[model samples]
Target: MNKPIGDLHCHPSFKPCNNPDISDIWTYKKNIHPKDLFKGILGVSPRRWMVNLFVKDLATYTQSNLDSCYEGDNRLLFLSIYPIERQFLRPDRPFASSTFVQRFILAQVFGIELKRHIDSRIIQILTGFSSTKVVDYLKSVYDSEYVDYFKTDFSLEYKYINQSHLSCSPNAEDNVATFQLVSNYEEYAALRNQNIIAGILTVEGAHALGEYNSKDLVGDKMIDDLSEENKEKLKASFIRNISALKDKEQFEFTPFFITFAHHFNNLLTGHAKSFGEAKNKSMPGFSNVFNQKNGLDLGISDFGKQLIKSHLLSRHNGQRILIDTKHMSLQARNDYAAIVKALRDEGDAMPIVISHTAINGISTRAKAAERLDTNQLDKKSYVSRWDINITDEDIREVFDSNGIIGVCMHDGRMPGGKFKDLLKSYKKRWPQKEFISKLHTQMFLTNVFHIVKVNLDHIRTLNAQIPIEENRIPEVQAWKTICLGSDNDGIVDPFDNFNTASTLKDFKTRVKNAIDMNFDPLWKRFKILDIKEENYRFFNENEITELKLGLTSEEIVDRIFSDNIETFLSTYFVRAYLEGTEN
Candidate 1:
């Protein structure tokens, strides 16, 4: 592996959603006299990862100071927008049965990124809809009679909209200097090169659709039970009330928003050993007459199945596509497997691969999560969390599907955790058939110290085991996938041992010093910093510069870096979604 390896996941251009902190920071960057080039680049990069720097907790901006320093570079950024698709039977989600209500509530409750709790209330009302509580209240005043007509609530909608204007500024003035942001968004595809990847947008969830023929079913008594603590009760209430609102001629339930945590977690509950049968189709799935038993059945929602089916026809059309099944749940994977077989049966070739993984047969340490101690130090206690990794069965599926799985760096996705624990987590996620605890926010932020530690440990683990180069994680001595996925501009930690944009020289110097000594510079090796310094690469410019294996070889390298992604997009990505592909 002689090349200057790069990564597919890097967000260099992002912006803050309406917090006031940027004004000051921008001012500092602009005005800081005796400007140093190094400081300038470093200063801007952090602002990208941690938006907290751009806004005050109180939501005010320190603008005066920022205007002075940030006078130099104003790079237009390509930002991501979350389309709120999480509500759509998203795969690998633990709490599926409650996702619709939960995600909806969560979107409103914590989606302060786009609007405040109060503002969301207005959008609901003005749009002929309202929050769970308000909708319930309205149901009482208005019988189910006018429910289908959004116009029925025109008076209230107008009143709320008026109130919103009044609250922001005088009714006559639209010049308030307020900045705000949100979740559940749909970013324009054309904005990619602009340096943005607006987060996900919401696609129609199955639950959001009900029988289309019914009319006038959403109303009052339905409102009465809106606040019930019990989930099943709430679900039943929604189905009954919303179902009843329609005219008998038009009423049919549309399964929009989604629901299907329908299966039990046998692995966690001790009903099964590690995910032994974690195959696509072989795992949990819904059996309908349309599915032939032996075909690869990926457990997708009816909507997902359609999407995957369409995706396959449009993109794969017999071309190879690496389907990273990492984020998919057991059932979803199975569903896809079925679909794959069906495609093959029809003489359609579908080449797919699981991008990264490990073996499952290995026992991993418990505290293998990437975590941190109170002192911000890395510790090796494998708590119940961060121990989950891909399993052996997971690998077998990918392999059987003729897929490639990348063994990743960053300690099996559990940073700052012990090496052994990380290994165990990886094994589970890969060739094994069991699942592990997910990495939550606390573990993510707290695990910085362990990242640094694990990299060190990895170096020690294979000091005498493998060849000079492969020993650097990503090899048999150390298999690693692209670890740049969530370095998040080095703002968030657990990559405690990473190189800052500023001290890159020092980091590389240390690695070089150790190269000939037969010791490991583990974490350092995983990172790619300052592309100018090509020597750090196993096969840097010197090795690759003139070695013409012919145009095809160069073409292959080109394909490996950006071309593969392009090919992937050509095979599957909607050109409509190609807006920001370059970045």
Candidate 2:
């Protein structure tokens, strides 16, 4: 049996449907239906057939949905708690508009049935709603009543797992797996010991904090232009928002990390350049949306720096929640790293994390800029320049801080320049169909394989850079930094073969196969990389031990899939608590 897998980042709550009872809609997919008759003849369930056929939303995908976690044997997940931005739901979007033609298009494209009560006037009101109003609406959803309902419903529907439990209780049935939300390393270990699926809570965007509008104002305005009274109000609102997030009883949620920025510019920090029509065109209201003017190319503002110092960097009740650097602009990332380094110099060990990301081999701004100047940038290098991916410098910083980086599975981030070529081939072969059958799966597998190889190469590169005799960081230590964090249900274009969470099981097999085929050749190439012999002058006894236990391909796969991140959490969180740094 394969070792249990953990996704360091995913969003199960970001559903396409506006229905309050979204859980019911997901549950309904599991119910046997009359439509299963034809599928039954082919030994496939109707739900499975539909999922493999027409379902494009990540929420409906097997591994992404709550029920499918058990089926897929994905025993651990970092559930990203997010409040949808109002921009995507604006009434001007074709699907959100109420005209008969627009409604018809919506139904045809997304299979959403429009009701008569939802007319153009209602949509206009919703679209015109302020970000403040949207924040209030989301707050209600996270309130106790809704939180309790969500927890209870999931637990009742999936009897083997109890969503409300923070630690595992032994099950009388051998096959049953308990699911629990872990707040710290101890709780995580306790659940894992009993074969539980641990769910670690994280926030996708700080915009969910309800200070978006105020933050935006502060970002855009000069202090001289704003009234003292208004500035005071903004300050108060920011504090209140932070207080509410820390209020575990009222919200029933506390995040381990909050991604400082996302697709849009949040008031707190400047976002990375994640904008493009090709990426957002499929979503309603997002066709022409871009992040260029709204905090793009900007770094953290004065207010943002203070906000981080007071909330994220400061301990509350003896605990500090780290900030994730996934969506921050390159300047913002550099600013954040400098701040963290300053703190470390002052005897603080605040670690840095890229919760979900891919690597671009370029380590410095000079190198990246030179590649861009010559128009010789690889896809990954271009992506890194855009700040959507990590650079070698960032990876090294993460390693120095003893922080883990979760490898994202989104096709855009994954290595390989084959997707465009594959698309061309598919379009030529099957002009009448949107995609050539089975080709998506093949391309997805190929992309995943390339991702694995690139990550391994990154590890080797880091190893080569380190002074060999100093710590002589074992190749395994670098390998331990890589782990799965498939951004499913996070508005990601998932790899085609591993399109949904449920498909992760098959991906594990493919990973193993790819390793078998590519590991030795890659190792040979790594061994030949030019390095100064002085780095290995005084190799120590401990270094010799690690070198002898040289990681096997299977062991590396196991670490990436399960052991590494688990170890990271245990070491980081447990140390935080023991050192009196955690609340």
Candidate 3:
């Protein structure tokens, strides 16, 4: 009777079965398999209904007909061997085999070697563009008819860029490199497929050292860091890049979730505070803290603050934006809390999302690996949020601020079976009626609604509890909206399940069965048999009505089935259904 009724976090790798007949789904678990990870391009039978179901990439998205969507696994399932850097994203240039000579020729097409002049004028590098050289590189990629699709994902993910990196300059070594290229030459090479109607261009990190005051370069006068002419030249270079994307090719340059370093602090800090922080940047090139020589004031806490300032520059552009917090720090998370308040103060409703991350502090250990799909025959090392390094107070800070956090699938300290956890955590934290009554006169200045509470933690400490007539924030208001925020392909083989990727059969069997079970008998002496589906309606319909998210219980059901995830995502990512339409 005490079992929870809803699931907030689950990966769609499996099917969620709500049918009330098969209560003990362990019998059906045998049907799910690990190889299902290759469900898309490999062996997954293409079911027609699978059309509207693929997880839309949170990055760049153009008008897409689900029919055209090659619903490949989100993870890098396989990579081509012949290509130097081939993660066969699409059946593009990398997928095609080329002779070493051809690869050499393609690489040698653009031989522009760059260097830094003693002039502190770094912005001039943008004007260093060449029509012939740029055009030649573009031809090398598309000239071969072997490509299935030439995909161009441009983001100067500099972590992979190092001394062997041809795009960067050797002369710029002595002085700090003003900027780093996100995408290497190959990605840009495949961009202008004049025949290919749509390509994608993205602005990576904001680490580029532009003159602080951009507007001052308007005239043919001298500016502060670079000459006014150099500033103008740099501005022109960026304009050319944008022009090429929008005008020359019908590429949709919808940029979202762009950041210099995903977890910037972990990268900036030379010393690792934790094993997780050690591998902050995927590419390990030149790195040092911003100190006096870097012409910046330094502080212990400023690293977190600086990351926010850099992101806010793009966020404040007045072009309705979705701020990304994937690599942001807890200090920065706290800072963003203030930023959101100030934004709401100004009446801005632009939504934001932390696209990828497990519930903080959940993966208790560094290497807690669980096979994505299991029939519950093996030991389950479930991770609790308290186990993750991040504190409970930090989670409260985020939720209290009205931010939505997604449950990631990859293994970590965070626990699975989110449907039950969602209700358990809410009931645990709710304030009691007596405490609310005593504080109501002072807290809300009125004896309005009573509070009902249960403590999940420190169970023995909470005793002699009595039921209250009403609940906190009025019976009309409780945290009603819990949405699925799954990371399908970040890690594990073929990805799956509630806390992981799951096949349709696995979802219905394991995740649904766990949620439907009556855990009230779990504490008893005899073996606690899981109740059959006919025994309970699963969710308490009355409490469901009392819950609030400005939507009815029927609507909540719709959300639990589908809508909420869309609404939470619509706040940040563009929906596949509306890719062609304007935001």
Candidate 4:
């Protein structure tokens, strides 16, 4: 039996961008007569087979086509309910380009041709519009088309499970997997016992609340321009959206955490620097700049603080929705941490989480010394220097608050600079194409191994720097902070080896191999370091038993795969019971 794993962050509903139909061309080519007739046109041997077969396989797993989940036993998925940003469908450069060639590229290459079906006038109206307009457009499409599409593909034994169900246990006897909407740890545990996939809902951006836009002319106005009536209207809309999500009788898809900011800024918070659509030079007609100027370095505004106090931190049907700090600007992050700390000091505890992140290893002193005044700099000046990765201070804050940090799987985040170092070493050892082809299978696995090794080494180094009595944090406790958050189908370029959801099944074997290969060497180095230190303590009997007897590998893999995340959920949801339930 395959061991079950959990992905704390993923976009299972993002199929339009990762369309499976794009692979049909390759499938058709493979069926052509003689198969060798196109050997000259297409490369012969393995390259041809790779282009035809492997590409098709990649397509099938990239999209949330239902079969992708069953391909691997993904038991717990924190599924993101996203409203595709309107910038893609807008008919302008900063939003989108309506040129003939741009349309062709979007349709034939990128699989984002839905705007072509809509009226040109409507597309123009959507361009450079508020997030409210974009959300309304998305909701209409979701209700009319996308909902039914998902049901049809995921139906089990000819019976379609209603999407509105607060929780479901679809029959799994027909070689298809079951999906259950789980809100709390109790529900998650129950679903896992039945071997059903438990999906916890999350929202990618607060723009789904329907009253914000990154490029609004308000600029620094900060809600002061709104009349009393308009303020009430906006508040009503926000409440209505939250009520809809929490409605148990209807769509019970309330978010566990909402990322307040994304590629663009919204009314609720400022965003960190994110690459614009211009990153794809192939589509030069489309401008990449969105909210680059307005919300790049600004922290939480006064209106944002009010919204959090009045709505976000308040209970929704006896449960409070948490905030995700994935896309928050550095200033925003600091403000949020301070707010959470203040709340805790006042006897109200809220756990902090960064759903998908990388470690920057930036020291607290260095970060404090840098100037954060954005007004003096050009719009593009700080784009490259923006620190999106969590620093040591951020990690300590999360640890102290009993929070979890999910390590992202993208090449840009996970391995960061380590990937280049590993690639260099691999090329030096194996210079031939055939050898490199064989090595590609293990590349992602090796990268993950190195990431964990580097993280552990950093933790040990930090521990050595601090007095043991002052910093009582155990090395193993820090390891628990690392959880899997594969942002699959979120427009990320996946690691070469672990290209899709299905490849996760093989990740277990690779993790085991990594431990076996590095354990003895690490232990020997630790022993040598201990000899030079005063008041050195030997490895505890439990540690020796766990490492020498193979228990360490099992425990570490278990924690990273599912155990730690489950514990986090239990901790987070248990607060509702401890505090009085809101009526």
Clashes of each: 141, 6, 26, 2
Q: Residue 183: error of model 3 in Å?
A: 23
* Model 2 agreement with the true structure over 169-230: per-residue lDDT tens digits: 23233436655776678777766556576777777776666432333332444322346765
Q: Give stretches of model 2 more than 4 Å off.
A: 16-18, 24-63, 91-175, 212-230, 247-253, 278-287, 290-292, 365-385, 412-418, 423-471, 519-549, 575-583
Which candidate has the highest lDDT of all? 2
lDDT of 3 by residue, 291-359 (tens): 111211111134334433333323332122234443344444445556666766765543334433433
For model 1, residues 1-583, the per-residue Cα lDDT tens digits are 1222222221121111111222211222111111221133333333222222111111021211112111211111111111111111112222233335443433332233422332223222221122453334344323332222122222222222222221221221322321111111122234334322122111111222221111112211121222443323333433442333222232221111112111211010000011111113312211110111111112454534543454223332221112334434444555666777787788654544433222222122212212211112213333213112333334334323333332222332343234344545545654332111122212321221122223234445556566686544431111111121232221122222221222222222333323222122433322211111011123333322222222233343333333333333343333322222322
Top candidate (TM-score) = 2
Q: Quantify all predictions' global Cα lDDT against the true fold.
A: 0.26, 0.52, 0.25, 0.51
- What TM-scores do the predictions have? 0.33, 0.68, 0.37, 0.66
TM-score order of candidates, top first: 2, 4, 3, 1
Output the lDDT of residue 44, model 2.
32
Candidate 3 local Cα displacement, residue 294, angstroms: 16
User: By summed lDDT, which 10 consecutive residues of candidate 1 come out lowest?
Assistant: 266-275
Residues 1-583 of candidate 4 have per-residue lDDT tens digits of 2457888788664442223332310111111221332244322343334223312312223433234555556677787755555443433322344345444443332223343333221222222222344345545433332122112221210121234233332323454445667667776766656746667777776656654323332244334345665545555666666665555554544568877777555545777765422223344222222334456666777667766655666663435778888878787888888889988998776778888765544444147226442212112221112256565666667766777777666643433223335444656985655333333323333323323434445566767778866565565565556577777766564555565666676665555554544335533321211110112233433433333333466676677777779888887755463233523
Stretches > 4 Å off in candidate 3: 1-253, 256-318, 350-352, 360-401, 413-481, 492-510, 520-561, 569-583
State residue 195's C-alpha deviation in candidate 1, in Å: 15
Please list all clashing residue pairs in model 4, or write none if there are none: 92-96, 93-287
